[model samples]
Target: MRLTALGSRLRTTAWPIPFVWTVALGLWGLSREGSVWRDEAATWQVALRSTGEISRMVENVDVVHTLYYLLMHSLFECFGPSTTVLRLPSVLAAAAAAACVAELGRRLSGNLVGLGAGMAFGLIPSVQFYLQEGRPYALVAAAAAVSTLLLVALLQGRRNERGRWIAYACMILVCGLLNWLALLILPAHMVTLAWARPTVRTWIRWASASVAATAGVMPLILFSRTQSGQVSWIPPLTWHMLIGPAILLALAGVGALLDRPGARGLSATAVGLPLLAVPQIGLVGISLFKPLFVDRYVLFSLLGLALMVGVVLGALVEAVGRRSRSSARWVLPVVVAAATVALLPQALAKRSPQSRVDDVLAAAEQVERLKKDGDAVLFVPSARRDTKSVSPHAFTGIQDIALEETPERSGTLKGVEWDAARLRTEMLARQRIILVTDAGDVSKPADSPRDRTKLATLGECFRPVVDEQVRGRRITVYVRSASDSPSRLRCSESSR
Candidate 1:
């Protein structure tokens, strides 16, 4: 009687348990100790722009992230800018996602399953990484979870079918607007409807909702193509990348077998399997043509993995109860506790500044320390100007010698750069220059005429006096004698 009462109370309040748990996890290191990486730097710089400027800038580039930028603009206006303000939305979104996952588990299976899945969602490595990130993916995942819950409710013939369908369409539209790749969830839902063997009416309503959302996002789909070059840096899909998805699919498959599901009726397998497999397979199919197979793009699919894990946990408890009913109740809590212990190191590391690829703020601090007054600053390939854009105060006295126009004025992320001849002319006049670029491990050779000119002119005229690589950025202070000329110092002799 006592255990039953506890279980009933837990089910009644299941959503908050995971909601609070995930929020706590997200806030544990919300600021990453004031470190912001390049990707978040994009968010920071763009979010700080005025709405009109952001609108104009997205017209030329990054239209895909327009809604997110606009949303962040409002948040920045309301909360004054800081790393906490920047990342707190993601934390809240992740918590909402966890709450939705818990409710979905409860509806589809039972209270314990829902609670376990919701709590497990926070512990997943990928979810943990993005929970505190200043990006749109967590929001997309939260929207996906809500839409899936609505779909399940509709499948069960819940009340207010009409209103549920509208809410469902809105969530899907939100996901698509945030990222069109998220439209892949529609097919996953289609598979779930097929598995459930819904009536023709249900199929038609589902199709109508899905099509409406897709149509709403079609304009963005068409417009983003003009800005496709923004993703040109995403490497082609390879066998190495397949390893992670394959392992995930294998684990979900094990959960399906443990589920011992029927061919129909909204089993966890019916929903979870398709959600896990379809989007991954679909991404691979698209990558065949465009090579845009980044896992973060399809992050919503992690909910399916969480669901499958819930199924396994629930089944394990049930089997143990057959032998000893008294023992079954403690199984899940113990497993969760053990998993928490095992993940402690990774959880701590994820909160550290070193977790990201590079810390732009750390690099900015280095530039402040290494710079001399009146030093001319240059960003090789020009995009490295993001370091300066993000922390303009650090370069307060320095001149951007190669910049032709500011990023805002040019409606671009890194702004426009001077022509090659002008860049060379400017370099010749400077006695000392602060050259900022990527670290040696990640740096590529100059790919543009102007960037090549910057490097060549530096190698032939100046010698690197203060060479420091910090946090994935190389800030080299190059000095040249007033009498130095290309003839006096060869590019081969600089050793820079």
Candidate 2:
């Protein structure tokens, strides 16, 4: 009797542990002592821009992220900017998601499984990747996980629990609005409903909630469709993508089969399996038909994988403990410690600028050092002309000679481009010119009409001085000399 009561008390008291760890881990490098990437800088830039500018910019581009941009705008207005202030929302969102993962695991399985699952989620690499990001993804995951937890609660409760059902519906809307991709979880949720043969009233409650969520996001969904070009860069499905989901599901599948008693209903396997499997499989399969296979977009799906893994790990630890009674207590802790050590390198890497592909901070700093007073900058291709958006302080003294309108004035992320004649005039105005372009563009034809105008003029009118490559881009500088000739630098209108 005493042992049984003690077990129950421990389970009740363990709810806060996962949340505490998540917050601590999420805040580790969130202050951004390292470099800030373009995407991170984008959140800062868009939020602080005058509301009207942001409003106008989204009308043509970035319509999908408008809601998130407005939320950050309000946040900046309320709290003066700080690195901590900027990313704290994501930190807290990750923590809440971790906690919810634990709670859901406990509801579906039992105490030990919940603890393991929550810890797995808090430490999982993908979750850690976005935990401190200023973007909407971490919050999207938290909202989706919280909504699923509520669904689990409703399924476990009495059919009369209309309050839980209603809240679940609202949460679905919040999750869906946070990121449209999150709505994919709803179809995976059918697995849970299928597992429970509910009464007519329960069926009615589920249908009503599902309909409200679908209805809530229809307008935004329509708008996002028009902005599909934004994600046109998403590549078609590949072998690596197929291999990744297959591995996650295989581990989760094995765990489901090995789950021991004390785990609650069929809900653990039913909910976790579909949550992990359906989104990845369905998304990839859909990608084969269309092109939407970016892994970061579905980061929340890992929580399902972690939950299932926790149950499996818990069962394994317990089984080993029984088999080796003398060394039982040390076995699980040692195994967990070993796993933690293995994950330490990835966790440490997240603290550096290397966490992102392009270090906008570093690239901007290099530009600041390269150019002198009266020098003009040109962003080739015009589509990536948002360098000033990354480091306004660094670019403040430099001029963008080829830019027709500033990104904010033009109400666009990349800013409006100058026509070839205007660009030639702009280039002629400054003797010292600095050019920045994507590193990937290096191998493109140097003399192509679209590209050669900038470089051709550079070679004819000036002498090459510095050519350097940085984190995500390349920068080159040239200065006018006695050998310069305007006629040779000029391009015909037909070429343009």
Candidate 3:
């Protein structure tokens, strides 16, 4: 009796132990990963660049969210711009999001529901992946959670309660600044509000505030639109990818409709709509135009997925209790165990060292040793023109003048035509030229054999210096004929 009473007292507290456990799990998963992949590398590069130069860089490149960049810029300034430092903000943001989910769950349902939702979020594979990445996706996820929570509070407002309205507006604006996808969450809000039957005056105030906020965000939308044109690799969007999320969403909707009055239906819709809408829209948009659907772009939806899963599990437990009251004791544990089993693979993958940015840096370091002074590194064939599909932007340690076909296609450097003579002349004027080509490009059968022979002809003009492996692919470096000249002298000193 004494032990049971103590357990009950502990469960009644605001900060339950299960909520703490869920947060710990999220933090652990995020900290296990150490790699800053390609897009992450691009984010780091942008953040490292001077704030004064950011607007100019964004004009030249394709960056959608200026606010995220600005926040990362500030973070880099304080943290000294290493991969770990660059990624820390996202990690913390994701952890905070898990906490917020639990808090929201507690407010809507009870401690058990909140704890389950938080744990589900913490264990999600996609959530773990984005939280460990050095990008804005994790922040977006956090903002989405905060926005959902605020919206819920607003819907549940009492007579003479104006504070929740202000809070809701502020959360929406902050989410909008975080990413354009925040706009996607608005339809969910509108649907929920219409179902809730709020007063006409409240609706008018919300709509007016929303219009003003949209007007405020117009400059950013224009800037993003201008940058979108530079991306040439966007693919068509499709409907097939929407099937799984859509089915799940329908189930969630049914669950909401079946829910008892007051908290159940409202909570179900709050979690279900965003999860269903963002990805469904994103995937469909991607099928039509390739630029739109990126896996990282839907990181915010993981929160909704977690919530939906938690609600379903909670409802299942309730159902089981109605059939066999004795089974209720085992239901929560069984749900947690099943979730852990499903999430094990993703949790382990996040911690693997093979997924790190240091691998690319190491490869670049190897290339550096073989080059003489006045060397230019050529990026052969070039990457996809779309910013969305471009290779991860992280640089290895090797620094060389990059060659490409179009500046728009390559994020960091301008593209140069494949002129062997011009390249040789540049190398002779300097002392060495290192040509790095993706082996996958070489395997393609469409290129003229003569054009394909460019590397061989260029190799003949210079001495083979070094060939290094980066992420399992060989990148060869070559020295110019005048390898012993003063240009080499300058190159040697500069490389050091």
Q: In TM-score terms, which candidate is top?
A: 1
User: By summed lDDT, which 10 consecutive residues of candidate 1 come out lowest?
Assistant: 487-496
Per-residue accuracy of model 3 over 1-496 as CA lDDT, tens digit each: 0122222332554234444554455456443333434456567656765666666556666456567778888888887767667666777778777777766655655555555667677677777777777777888878777877766666667444466566666666666676665666666667667766777886886786566666666677677776675545455444555576677567556646533335525555455555556555655554474456555666776666666655665566667767775675477678878878787776776766455433334334444555454456555443311111122232233333424344433333233354554444444444555665444422243253333444654554567666655542346767655437764453332332
For 1-496, candidate 1 gives per-residue lDDT tens digits of 1234435767777889999999999999888988998899999999999998999899998899999999998998999778998899889998999899888877777777788889899999999999999999999999999999999999988999999999999999999999999999999999999999999999999999999999999999999999899999999988999999999999899888877453248888888888889999999999999989999999999999988888888788777777877898888889888988999999999999888888889889999998889999999868888898889999998999999999999999999988887887788878899999898987998999999999989887888999998878889999984445556643323332
Clashes of each: 0, 0, 20
Q: List the residue pairs that clash in candidate 2.
A: none
TM-score of each: 0.95, 0.91, 0.77
Q: Report the alpha-carbon TM-score of model 2 versus the true structure.
A: 0.91
From the highest lDDT down, the ranking of the candidates is 1, 2, 3
Model 2 / residue 178 / CA error / Å? 1.8
lDDT of 2 at 166: 82
Error (Å) of candidate 2 at residue 236 is: 1.3
For model 2, residues 1-496, the per-residue Cα lDDT tens digits are: 0122322543874447778888988888776565666677778778888789899988878877787888888888889655676688888988898888888877777765676777788788888888888888888888889888888777777454778888888888887787777778888787767766556777788889988998998888898888888888788888987888888999899988976433234556777888898788778877898799987778878879878977886676567656764454454457567877899999888877666766666768888998798888877656545567757777767788777777889888877767666777667667788888767633344533535677767766677799887766778888775533457434333333
Rank list by TM-score: 1, 2, 3
Candidates 2 and 3 compared: the better one by lDDT is 2
Runs with alpha carbons beyond 4 Å of true place in candidate 1: 1-6, 260-264, 482-486, 489-496
